[model samples]
Target chain A: MAVFKPATSNLLHIEVINAIINAIVSGELKPGDHIIEQHIAQEMQISRAPVREAIRELAAQDIIQFIPRKGAYVAPLDPRNIEGIYLLRSYLEGLAARLAAPRLTETDLNEMYLLNYQMGEASLKNNVDTFINLDLQFHDFICQHCEHSQLKKMIDGVQLQTKLFMNMSKWHLAAHSELHREMNAHEPILEALRARNQEEAEMKMREHIVMAGNRLLEYLVDNKSSKNSKKEDTETVKN
Target chain B: MAVFKPATSNLLHIEVINAIINAIVSGELKPGDHIIEQHIAQEMQISRAPVREAIRELAAQDIIQFIPRKGAYVAPLDPRNIEGIYLLRSYLEGLAARLAAPRLTETDLNEMYLLNYQMGEASLKNNVDTFINLDLQFHDFICQHCEHSQLKKMIDGVQLQTKLFMNMSKWHLAAHSELHREMNAHEPILEALRARNQEEAEMKMREHIVMAGNRLLEYLVDNKSSKNSKKEDTETVKN
Candidate 1:
């Protein structure tokens, strides 16, 4: 686990949980790796109880799995699970876009526009992280105006899951190059919302999610291929 | 907690988790009740560790909240959370219904029809539990035919959260009476899907979810009133 010792007097479990989640999301903890509580506690200089609590918490979110007698392991990202999450996200987000269209204030539109511009700047400067952050901000800005708290939470939960995939795919040059196209896609969506055309907004949002999902899947396939190749090379060298 | 003999050796944590969940769902463990791990373990004739593990699992799902020093407590069903879940479910299930409609085989249709019929029968017999089970079966059947694993998982998760509200509402007679209407609502959805009319299928499914959400909210309001009145009566007697 990535060691960053910080003061943790309150909510020790939550703090530890976030650290482990960040480690997993940042690729410091690979899938199927055993998460020994003692190791984590020692690294963080905390008791094993809090670390154990954090592991259990992660397991509940399906981010990890605990086998009795065996230890806790990072949950593997199953493509099927990704597909399921994206599919639901697309439909819910499409609804959010539709609901937000008629109700989107001028301020909401302006905020989205500003975010989109910043995203473009980030893309031009080849700042993938900034571009990604802005991209998330733009979508979130629209969701903020949706007036449906339930929809927003559901979308946010799925978005968190997708973020892991997004981080993994960030290493791909083509993925970074698609930032401009992504920004363009948001323009039509914002325009539709500004025009109070719910159908158009919903359609655009669905298309955006579908396109993103497809791209992420492609990146995953490529990543898997490279990983397999590397493994084969190691085996051949050993032989 | 419902007493279960310790015949089953494995799945200890799951069993404990299910027992506690059942208490919450059954209203035996009311919201705000501090979950005593020792008390629960003694009731279920299990060790404290499994109970603690179960509590952690529940906390992760937001079914309960864990307090340091103070024990875990059943999470109160927040109306906002319910609304958010319903909104997301509406969109996702709408998509599933639309997708499943055209792809639904004769077997799928027959299965759904049977489930619906069984739901009606259970409702007529005033077997709310049986009716609810059939109702879930009907929806799950639709999701299975939808052929989207991601959609199914999302739907299932949303349904799980809604179960608490659904159980509370089950106490009301009108909620029980609406079973037939709910079954009828599925007819047009199935018809639209069978006819390969995706738009109609989607519309019907969305309508179904919206109506269910509305009904559940109304039921929750009534449940709250009844609970308040009962407390008032007790206070009056004490005075």
Candidate 2:
């Protein structure tokens, strides 16, 4: 759930797509915000051709939307879809962890141990961004070690959706106390993998994702309900 | 596994995407076949703009591949990737069937029952196309009614890979005897769904996919081994 770095490819359209994605990930461009093709072209100091092509590609990827006469906008993070993303990620990540278990080198386990230790320090300092970076790095290591490209791709797509709501930076700051809960979840998965227990590794990883997803959704719902009540109070005052 | 009817939208690019996919699915275009933008444009009587655009989109989706100097080709269906696809599909489809069990109406069960019955007939008649279509239909019904768009999308993407190998025609023709095994697999899924047992439904669906995947891979491996042996025999004869 760390901030998305733009793709490092040299292709202009790909660069444009990553730049536009960077804006959305950074909160500079919120969901449902109209994407002006001209504005993006101007901002990137590039011609509209690659920018236009980027938008078309993004739309095809479901990363953006196109309205007939209205141009494109960022796709909103639907709570329902977010839930589904977590469920899919849980199974897929579990599969990744399971597959990577036998293949994990001693150096891989050592790195994970270091990452877990860093996560603990970041939690104590209340540095959410650093904590999330480590968390994503840890997961990414497992995904990278996975033998299957298709499975890795599926996991990456769902995790991107998770970024829409969690945004990596903000959520970790807000949920400092809950970091221990996640720490608890990660322990079992790491242990299972270290022990090379594929079944346990898969289930524990799945459980970790499901727990994190439920916690995030609960936070979102609570946040929404509080905002709704505040809006009602302001409306009453106006009346 | 049925012929991919193109998207009905007025978008020219979507139509182009589907037309190209249809050629791939129908075996008119084999893996690694070059997709000539101007050729398709001339064939479809449209400009090259949309065809070019469609190629980019499909490349992003992994349906096509772009090589720097070689131009775009259909993404080859690797034996390794096919195994990964089935494993992922098993989990996702199982998830769909689980979510769908409690939500399935009487009509849904009855329809599935009829579909299952028809699958038996197709197997007995050695009707591969009909069998594959019905197989897709049965799975699609569960995915459509699963109440999760994201899960359905993931399932659909993996199933597309299956088409690369099966293509609804040749595989069935060669593996005629194995059709009955598939029939045996479908029976338990229907029974579990009809009984409204969520746990049983999920496990059964997962098991069914795993079983079918194993059979397909076994058949493919056998085919490859035989071909390689025949090559060795021909070389010996030449010597």
Highest-scoring model, DockQ: 1
> How much of the real interface does each model capture, measured as fnat?
0.71, 0.57
Query: How close is each model in CA RMSD to the real structure?
Result: 4.8, 6.2
Please, what is the TM-score per model?
A: 0.80, 0.87
What does the interface RMSD come to for each candidate?
Answer: 3.7, 2.3
The numbered model that scores best in TM-score is 2
Docking class for model 1 is medium
In the predicted model 1, the residue pairs found to clash are: A84-B150, A150-B84, B101-B193
Give the clashing pairs for model 2.
none
lDDT of 1 by residue, A159-229 (tens): 76777777877768444576666656677888888899999999989888888888788777767765752
Location of the lowest summed lDDT over 10 successive residues in candidate 2 chain A: A230-239
**How do the residues A1-239 of candidate 2 rate in per-residue lDDT, one tens digit apiece?**
21223234667777887787778888767677777776666666666777878888777556787776689988776677767778878888998998899999899999998999898887777777787778888888899888987778777766666666668336644555666555545778889989999999999989888888888878777677655422222111110
